[model samples]
Target: MTNYEVRANIRVVFGDGALNELPTLLERHHPKSILLVSSGDYVDDLGIGDAVRQAADSLGATLIEDRGVVPNPRLEHVRELIETAKAHNVDFLLAAGGGSAVDTAKSVAIGLAAPEGTDVWDYFTVGHAVEQVPTLKVGVINTLPGTGSEVGRSAVLTNLATKEKFGVEANNLRPVFTIVDPAFSRTVPQHFQAAAIADEIAHLIETYTADDTDVDITDRLLEGALAGALTNAAKYADDPADDNARKQLHQISLYQHYLNFDRNSDWAGHPIEHVISGDYDLLHGEGLAIVTVAWLRFIAAHKPTKLVQLVSRLYHVDAVTFSEEQVVRGFADHLEALYGRLGLPTKLSAYGIGQEGVDIVAAKVTAGGARTVGNYYALSQEDVRALLSAAL
Candidate 1:
């Protein structure tokens, strides 16, 4: 038995026109002041800011707009938003974009609720206790489908000053309500949508590849998410206007988070990609797109069983017709082909990262006296360097 705990805390409003329920969701909180967090151009282009303001007006709540959030959510910007929320006495936070915006809002909530004179970054540090930190209520209007920050308790943020990226997990930081409107995904650029699909695939594979035994039920859900994402992603690529495909992908991204409840999953790629993307200001999903294959290749050398099963089931590779090594290569090549077809990066060099950059990222992952990462294979710094070099 895994002996894991499930936290079904977030409420979701799903379907087309779900954004209209933003006011209804906020009304339950009954906040007197609200901080609307998003990118300036995104909110302006989509009129999301105005919609939030109208919602606030309907609820008699004063709205404060903080439009400085960027992709890879910066720590300095989080600090600024924390101060802004404090100055306005914001009782609620409404994030109106994708993962970056939601993460920024979550970071701000953590910062705002910290005990006086305490640094918010401390919470992200390993071994830090975060019980009973009075986090503000957060609501989300998801304009993109990947990352699933809308319903997740973890938030990833970058510290530009230190050139490091870290993730913090606290139950209180999870959004109280999330609006998943498939129509909103249509407004996102195809490039980002492709990366979002890649992110969905990575999340599913990460959980499915865990070394834990007796996770058959969790494995089925993970496999189902993989199939659903792949089928819908291809449909989306063939016809970007397919509403059903978009809706399916959006819902899969949200629902897949629950699959992690009973699994000690392999997430070696995410931390490495986090450091690389934080350093280069790359799209988080695109970084994952590059690292996922390489990480799998490394893990396959040690734990080829799950991946072999994955390719056999998902890509229809026949175990009797092919060797395990060949099947693993087929999996990697097929994934790269899928991502390339979707117009995503398949190599770190695509983003101008090279041997030197790989060396830095390897060092960063092992920084602060850490020797390894990932529960499945436990990659050493040399392992990270070799795989990343091979990726390039």
Candidate 2:
């Protein structure tokens, strides 16, 4: 048997009307002041703005709101929010959107907690230790699904200056509380929802393939997440408004992080996807839909056994033996078709990236004297180039 660690942190409040209970939970936390963060005007448009404000007023909690977060939040935005919160003397942060919003809040938490004279970006780029670092009480009321940032102990931010996107992971960076309500996700556009599905699928597959060692329990957990995501993906296509389906997808999104037995797993496509999306401003999931297939295809050639095992678990196939070509092509084609059914792009070209971006992305991934990503087969710059070229 191999030794490992697993996390069962984060108090989860999940349901259809979970949003209505947000105020109750906030009161229990008893923060004196709060910073409410969202990506756009949806907080007001969806009536959540008023609900949370009323909740804050009930407790006499000072509420300051900011709508500056963007998809794949930039480092500059995080710094600005941290400064704003400190200026307002906000004692708590309420992230009321999707992963980007939550991630921005987490970075805020990290920044607030960091020792004075330390920059938050140092944690990601320079390996600054966040243990016992200063942090604020944080909570979430998430909209949309995928990007396990809601529960995962990581916050990703992009430095537009360097054209690089990276994440900082520390135990305290995870949300103190996460509220998952399918109702909040009901209005997400179908295409974006599809992109979210592709993202969750990549999350599961990356962790599932991170190790080849036989860990029966972990395998079972990952398999369940992948299967549930696929079932719900189909359900979502049929009716994006289906609460039950949305709930399942949201649960699967959380499970992506929940099943992370090891804090670090082989994130096969993320570094590549991050570069592509950060450079060209493409949807993270849409880029993953393209990069993930290519990443897996390259991995399949090198480790067909693990590739087949991954596919068998994901597709619920009983085939224990699969040819190299069969496994790669079959799994790639299946995933591509699923993306197609969900209205997600099957290639980087669909997002306006081309052969030109391949070298730039490869260079970005290898910038700062670094190479190779993931545990399955840490990809070298050449390997990354080939992977992107294949996707192109």
Candidate 3:
């Protein structure tokens, strides 16, 4: 077995009523004041802002709410949040929504700690060195299940001016504490639930298929997460409040979040989906669902052994006996059916993307260097074009 190292430093509280633990956790962190960050919609709908305020009140911590973050969080939004946090003299940051909200909080925290003249793009994409100001402690109350952003050390942000989406990673970006309550995710719209599941599935596939090694622990971890996610996804789609199913999905999401701490592989679907999402403003999970099927097909064609191993492990099949091609095609077909069942569009055309859009997506994926990064099968620009065509 090849040697690997995994490290995660976040304190996690998971259960049916994990959010209720926030007050005590905040007190332990010893933050005098916290900037409560969430989407405007969730401020009232999910009552997340209120919950944070209540927690702060119990802890004698001042709570300042910012409710303007949007899905696929924008760099400008992070800039504004940085300004808000600085002006409020906020001693800590707390995110209380899905991946987007948590990601926004992370970016804002990083930006606030960056040097005065640093550009948001420089911090995210250009790898510019900035003085590490006092790191702000962050706590997350995850209301959504898909992005696994709560325990993750990376945050994806969209640059509106350049129409690009990129992510940044810093150990400090990991939340100091995370609260996972499946009940909160039950309120997510059915369609959004499906998209979230798709995102989780993509995360599994990317990590599972990226390299060839005897990393049994990582393999089992990835496969278990995939199986749990798929099983819970079906039940959640039928009945969102199915506590058993919600708990399983929540566990899978949390597992994927911690999986990011290990250096297993590169994120294949993310770069492609980022470009498509940046251009079309598509839902992140839905975009992932659309791109992943194509990516799987491409990888299977080029790396049959790896594909067979993944399929065998994920589905508990005999790798030697199962026709590799059939397994690969079956996986894609299954995902397509899941997308349709979840009321998500299965093809680019379903989203009104045409031939020109396909070419644009192809170029963007290549430019992002997604096809080359730790992929078991290196993909050329033509390969990316073919995948785009297949997705269309």
Candidate 4:
């Protein structure tokens, strides 16, 4: 816990009727045209796309709406979007769905400003110079509170050619503004909602356990953020229209992202999970929920105090009464209870990724240039294989 600085740049407009503020927000930016990106059919079903169109139209800007973003957004699609924005000479973007949509829009913002055909992958791949580039102004109307992509200066996209899911973060990735109106989540189905909750928790876990130097302020803030996310997520699971619950979930997710957790292993169950999604198209959060339990259990002894801290905060349990090992397993049990409550998958087997799939996943992670994963344990390829087997 040395001296450090974290940047919080995106202007966030929260609470109900926030989407209606879009028109006025756009008026300030005053762009000639806007590219609206959405995740899937659900956005149309929920009327989110229409809402953005209405706002963009009222603002007198041509809105080029595309609902082509996939679950794991692809690099080719990003290039296509850049071309679409270029063809229309669109100067602004509105990400109107969840992480995929927001990430795609973010990629487009960077791509359109880069030298033509610069391959968005170049920004993320090793050995390439990721120079600062011009980018479009952006706005967000987020549906899922998962990836924090709305306010984050990062975008994740998969390359089917390489069967890899990678992320790029740059100075230009943050949105100019975001309107987190959870009213849009009122009709979201259970599975997707559960996965988002899992993702939010995963972010909290990564930051909380990544380092153990007792930055008490950071620890408590991360702990509180996890508590808020779980409480509201449980409320929404019981009744989706609980606007208070939804709003709290939105607020808590933003709080979690505001911490700026590292993307490495102990910080994330993600590296292990990323390869799973990259190979099999599993949802990112679902994989995290599945892998995190195994990861936490594996590292519990290595980072006992922090694990105790996390268990105390997330489960509201007395970690002091238990031995280090008991506290560790208790955390896993508590996570299981939360997962069951949210209807999240408990094992890789649930996704039909059996023994052979586990081998493939480990091989991919090792071949993907990760000599080690996580900050605390820094598991090597062999350790990752063992972790994958444990997850299985």
TM-score of each: 0.96, 0.94, 0.93, 0.92
Model 4, residue 159: distance off in Å is 1.3
Q: Pick the TM-score winner.
A: 1
Clashes of each: 0, 3, 0, 3
lDDT by residue (147-215, candidate 2, tens digit) is: 877888888888888777887777777787888877888877787778778889998888777554556
When summed lDDT is taken over every stretch of 10 residues in candidate 1, the lowest stretch is 123-132
Off by over 4 Å in 1: 44-47, 368-370
| Predictions in order: lDDT | 0.84, 0.81, 0.78, 0.77
Residue-wise C-alpha lDDT for candidate 4, range 262-306, written one tens digit per residue: 322255477778888988888888898888888777776555767
lDDT of 2 at 209: 73
lDDT per residue for candidate 3 within 33-52, as digits (tens), equals 78988876745675666677
In model 4, the clashing pairs are 206-267, 265-374, 266-374
TM-score of decoy 4 = 0.92
Question: What's model 1's TM-score?
Answer: 0.96
Off by over 4 Å in 3: 1-5, 41-47, 129-133, 260-263, 316-322, 368-374
Error of 2 at 316 (Å): 5.7
